[model samples]
Target chain A: MTHALAAKGPTASRPKPAEFIAFAVLAALLAVAPFALYPFFLATALCFALFASAFNLLVGYAGLLSFGHALFFGGAAYIAAHVAKVWGWPPELTLLAATAFVGLLGLVAGALSIRRQGIYFSMITLALAQMGYFVALQVPFTHGEDGIQGVPRGKLFGLIPLGDDRVMYYFVLVVFLCGLLAIYRIVHSPFGSVLKAIRENEPRAISLGYSVDSYKLAAFGLSAALAGLAGGTKALVTQSATLTDMHWSMSGEVILMVLLGGMGTMTGPVIGAIFVVAIPEVLNRIGGPDFAQWMTVIQGAIFVICVLAFRRGLIGEIAARLRRTL
Target chain B: MIPLLGISTQALFGQLLLGLINGAFYAMLSLGLAVIFGMLNIVNFAHGALYMVGAFAAWFLLTYFHIGYWPALILAPLGVALFGMVIERTMLKRLAGLDHIYGLLLTFGLALIIQGVFQNQFGASGQPYPLPEQLKGGTNLGFMYLPTYRAWAVVFSLCVCLFTWFMIEKTRLGSVLRAATENPELTRAFGINVPRLITLTYGFGVGLAALAGVLAAPIYQVRPLMGADFIIVVFAVVVIGGMGSILGAIGAGFMLGIVEGLTKVFYPQAANIVVFVIMVAVLLVKPTGLFGKKL
Candidate 1:
């Protein structure tokens, strides 16, 4: 058992230079893409990619599926928006406040949810997030349906003016890259190997003297913090936060993003996030207003097909085929 | 002079009655989930959608076929069970050897389809299902007035929940189910048809949800989105009760409902979230849940 566990550890801890190079190329493309594609659209995709990658950290690597991650993402957005708009904090400080607040919330939620495994864990997280939704709906500070609107983007470190859409797009790209790197580092860390051990066999890990619950809770917090990073950035870019962000459907959309990309693969979630977010926009441009709501139908179809036919996901399948050829 | 720190007796009784009514649906739905999970080891995420279908089925029967409430109650669950059987046979059967998450995903997809189609046909707005004339009136207790239909719903659901509990905990067939839940292969070797039992178990669970939906139609309007949020709340209830015990589920449901009602009386803002709060507290205190066996 120890031999088997030890063998699994090195693979997770070693980071491939190829993966980092691929990310760098992807980052370069994204950084330059606003010149060709719409900057706002590019920003939106970056925000969602960050969110999906954070979500992927939990579901893909640790094997703990949280269906309520929108709470962290959207809840932190509300916090960051409120702090920036009301407290007049610098953009960086507000982002920090939001990330910390979300990380704490994730700790509490993760600690509670890790008590149950599999579907029960998913349900508990979802229910707790719904609870957060109810609180947001009734709370006075959220501004009810309108949310905190016209949130000032404020200066990055009170220096670089993010007022320009192009500048803001670059700012969002940088944040997304930073968050993605953090996720990649976590997934390849020694702690990450322990998490994978717990995921593969909780009982054995527990029996082997590892504190399984703590590892799971840590992973959850890391995932939530990264999700908060995305949400906080998005709130700044969009200049508002609303109830829609905290909704369960948002949670479902994130799951779809991760599933479509490839769970456990570094490149898969980024690709998944781009496709899931951009597809609806593309469809709207082509099909017009009447077909906008059809996005849900399309998303639903993708989720079904992914689960039924392509469980390994886009990147995982490609990697497997390449390996077979090699 | 009225007592301090005491609500009027009438108001208290009324809230308690309302609590019992909400608890009835909770008991029925959670029981169905427990049964399905026990036998099939799969959580039916579509349980709520199936329940919504039951309410919609009843509405369709009334509007389209001119069927009354009694006939609709019987037909709605039967229709849902038939639908569940079809799902088990076609889609769910394919997922037998996969991880439990795949089963959940499949059901979730089915739920979206069912809810989406219904949403397309009937907009988000709710349609009223008239209370049957026989059950339209109220019974005047000295402390509070109880609507006859609400009373019947509570009593009838309690009976159904207990009947199910007894069947699973006491009967020979239930013993086989319990045995199968522990060791499907061993039970199969003993000549039990495990796969058929799984389909029927799913059907039974779906049927229970449909029955609850029929019961709920008169209280809550028949709406496409009705089951969506309720399912999430029921999930909290299941977590709090520790899905391992049927009696625990029923008890926790009524207990949490009363707590929720009390929250409404004191702090209405927290009522919607009180059950979740309790769930968190339960997790902190006893992670395995009050009656749940250790994982």
Candidate 2:
């Protein structure tokens, strides 16, 4: 709550009552979504939505495009899965530990990557993440090829068992809401303004006495921590952490979600995440991996079209049209 | 531990030769990358895919039209270069004046489409392209048994790399290209056709990748994923070489390939990752790359 109040967003205005009401409506909708939809799918999409939302905070709000977010998301998933399965840690402890570890990882990765700007920066992050992917494959604790399977969901706290699917979904939902709201507050906060200033013009920001690199690093660490949060929650929900999670392709998928949903908008990435995840799933239900291969072509086409034609994205364009933040 | 010191001179030299062959491809691909970047200011992310396309083009020509390796070598690159031209004029040209990242993203998408379509049509398992009859044999050297094709590949690619260097660095036409690359608007004012030069440069760079692909087809099994595997290493090579210097890109490619080969000999597990490790280290010391000018 403090972070949210602090971030008030890129704008430094008073807390508008409408913003609170809109967030409440969004929460109510997501809370009731599982009853109308598949609880398992909702749980899965929530993980990705959180991932994309966190990614948006960096790319959309902070003006840094990280092409290697899978380093955080998949890395944390593996760590959380390992701890839950082997160490028998409770859900909260595993999530906290995994997220914190990735935050540290992000700090190191971000520090090195911020040395380069623009395209070079993206490549640096990508190369480092690729290294992390190899680590996931070669490391013993990750179990190499098979990944850490049969991860125990464990209890939410000390008392409430989260073994039931419905209970687990609700737990995931609560975590998702916290992560989303935190991002919102971060974007609206004073720090977010500094980040925006850096994004808009770094030299000017530097001239104004802002430590641009430190701000960028802070934003990266925050983004990576939130991505870790999503990934850790996912491991608990799925009871597995496989290598595909860390693949460069998964990184691309998150970028796609952010681009499709609208980079800077509040709700764009979540909507985009749901769309990408859901479409593939619906196709999987009808056909197999062959059908999914076609999805790659479609995705590629979307990327080309989006860059050529629709840069604003669905939610972003809508928000612009309505003259109100979604 | 197995006696690392006891590894034979024959074994070491053999790996070195293999490394040189890999370096030949690396040199050719990175040279293409550097040239394209020089002209376009956009890294051609689909370069590896084009290389794969070149190999496939060769395969298709041989199977359907009875076009053998020698003829396919010349023809396949030409065909792929034409395709690259179309991509530039229609797609990549639109990305001009935008952030370099947009160009990167656009080409990345094209690569996915191309690789995906090929993978869909032909399974991921490799397809063998046999050595042409003349190049089928090998000669036993005191140091190593040099396959006729392997020696030819190393010498041939080195010549091509050098020739490309001469064309870009030495020739009168190259001076024009250099001028255009330096300042397009100024070059245009000097009565040069900058737009046409940009298009041709992209095609030529892509053709170089295809040429390497044709050279690689018989050596590495022609697979849909052949380029995907090497492209990352090439990116590492690019990062180390720095994008600004053509000579640097080629030099780094062969140099890193040897380094990778030596790593395989010393610490086999580290071979796959050694290039990336070096990249990080280089970045720490010289983020601008070894031969790179100030950005």
lDDT of 1 by residue, B1-295 (tens): 2332677766666777777878888888998998998877778889999999999999999999999999988999999999999888887888877878877776777777788778877889999999999999998876678899989999999999999989999999899998999999999999999999988988999999999999999989999989989889888889888888889999988787778777777777888999999889888899887878775
Model 1: per-residue Cα lDDT over A50-114, one tens digit each? 99999999988899989899999999999999999999998889889999999999998898898
Give the winner by lDDT: 1
lDDT of 2 by residue, B1-295 (tens): 2234788666777688778888888889988988888888888878989999999999999989999999998999999999999999999999889877778778877887888888888879888898999998899776567789988988999999999889988999999999998999999999999999999999999999999999999988899878875777888788788878878888898898888888888788888888889988988999888887766
Q: After superposition, how far is residue A113 of candidate 1 from its true place, in Å?
A: 1.6
The TM-scores, one per candidate, come to 0.95, 0.95
| Interface RMSD against the true structure, candidate 1 | 1.4
> Model 1 in CAPRI terms: which quality?
medium
Where does model 2 exceed 4 Å of error?
A1-22, A285-289, B1-4
Model 1 scores a TM of: 0.95
Clashing pairs in 2: A7-A188, A7-A189, A8-A188, A8-A189, A9-A187, A9-A188, A9-A189
